[model samples]
Target: MSIPFLAGAVSKLFLQFGCSEVRVEGLPAFVERLKGDRGVLTIANHISVVDEPTMWGVLPISTFYDQRTVRWTLGASDMMFNNTFDSWFFTKGQIIETFRGKGIYQKAIDTARAKLDEGRWIHIFPEGKIKQDTLTELRRFKWGVSRMLMESKGGRGEEAPLIIPIWIKGFEEVMNEEREFPRFLPRTGKKVTVIIGEPINDAIEPLLAEYQRKFPHPWVPITYGRDVQEDLKEEPPQLAEMRSKIAEAMRQELMKLGQRVPEVEAREPTKIEWNW
Candidate 1:
């Protein structure tokens, strides 16, 4: 096995082994979205540092063998690409090197868009950072997500990539940021629940329609999301509105998904779960 694939397989097993219990709901949506022909944009709330490697364990083991079925994610350069080995590791894991204050139009975002165009799956933490607050209380989403929304394309014209909102609970407990000792090692016996939401087209289509109506040209150029376009001189007022609306809509969807999932508080593998 390739280094990346082997690492992924081990992480998947490690997640299943570490947690006291891990549960997943709405897995069919996850299965269907990835299997679809169009690019997929998965937005999830950030809970812990291990979110990427651990949360992905929800996927079937067979999916790991197919790198395309795995996700290409935007990771903080400082966190994931600081040193030589780490950079190599994260890159092999399909993570794009993203800077924190560099705004959204940098090479990382563009790389992400290109990956999406290839019918790949891109997962993002819309909150843009780890916020281990209440499951229902989510941070305001960054406009980068809006940029991805406006920029990502499916096979057909004007067809946005499938938007799947995911809410992962209990990952934070595996390696709480608050823990001081043995900080790098993942703790065992934690409960985790993964809640996959349905496609959010219905909630976002109206916003997209309004964006098209007002712009009439296209919602392509995002000040915070896309590379610098030639025609873009000054950003219009509506662009900010559109980006904020899209970001907010994503937040709302995730919060609602969290509410629907009672496992967060109960910490039970309530529904049908894929576990060892």
Candidate 2:
């Protein structure tokens, strides 16, 4: 499975499905910053299932070529090979599956390391799940990304992969969840935008750690229209603080990059959502 072939296939599929006019920013500068280095990690905000494909479609081909030797480690749950076509596409993309509590952490790290050594890139969504709510903003980020960066650098030293933070917008309503696909009337298709922010090098950790020290005291835990209380109970104090800070930092950064949609204020969890 050739990477270029799969990238084209995925890019074509998104283009066919009304993903027109992808607006990409800062790629040229970022590419220049990378300076022929490809072994890197991209951290993104998860808004929809199409995010990965959209990213692939928009990334500069030359940048990918520079990092031609890399593989993207995708979430294990993302491997939904419902048919032969899907399986083929996934393989071609060089996507690797990663999971928790399955002794797969080292595998993901190793895979990323190998790709970096080969002068390629790896991509991951710092936000683990898709946020379907129109009003709800990005959820808090897990510690996995931080942990990965820290550990990778610890072992490799100067060979650590660079961390790039990418903020994307307007991908939530690609397909209407209520009426399913092709059921709703369309006046104008939504516009999708991807904004690539500056990369985070080893220097950013202390700032990140500083922010992590301030999260979660007595403020409201984010409610997602459900009894997510169980999920909230076990959060360690430091971890909870870290997540909150990440969410805040992400929100601020996205807004600065014009990726934040404030017109839609997120709603509290509805009764129906809780029952469900």
Off by over 4 Å in 1: 154-157, 216-233, 263-276
In model 1, what are the clashing residue pairs, if there are any? 20-190
Best by lDDT: 1
In the range 179-263, model 1's lDDT, one tens digit per residue, is 8888998888987888888889888877777776676654444445433333245567677778789889888988888886674
Q: Considering only N, C-alpha and C atoms within 3 Å, which residue pairs clash in candidate 2?
A: 70-120, 225-269
lDDT of 2 by residue, 101-178 (tens): 443234554566566555566777766777667423556665445545433442333355665777766666664445
Q: Which candidate should be chosen as best, given TM-score against the real structure?
A: 1
Query: lDDT score of model 1?
Result: 0.76
The per-prediction tally of clashing pairs is 1, 2
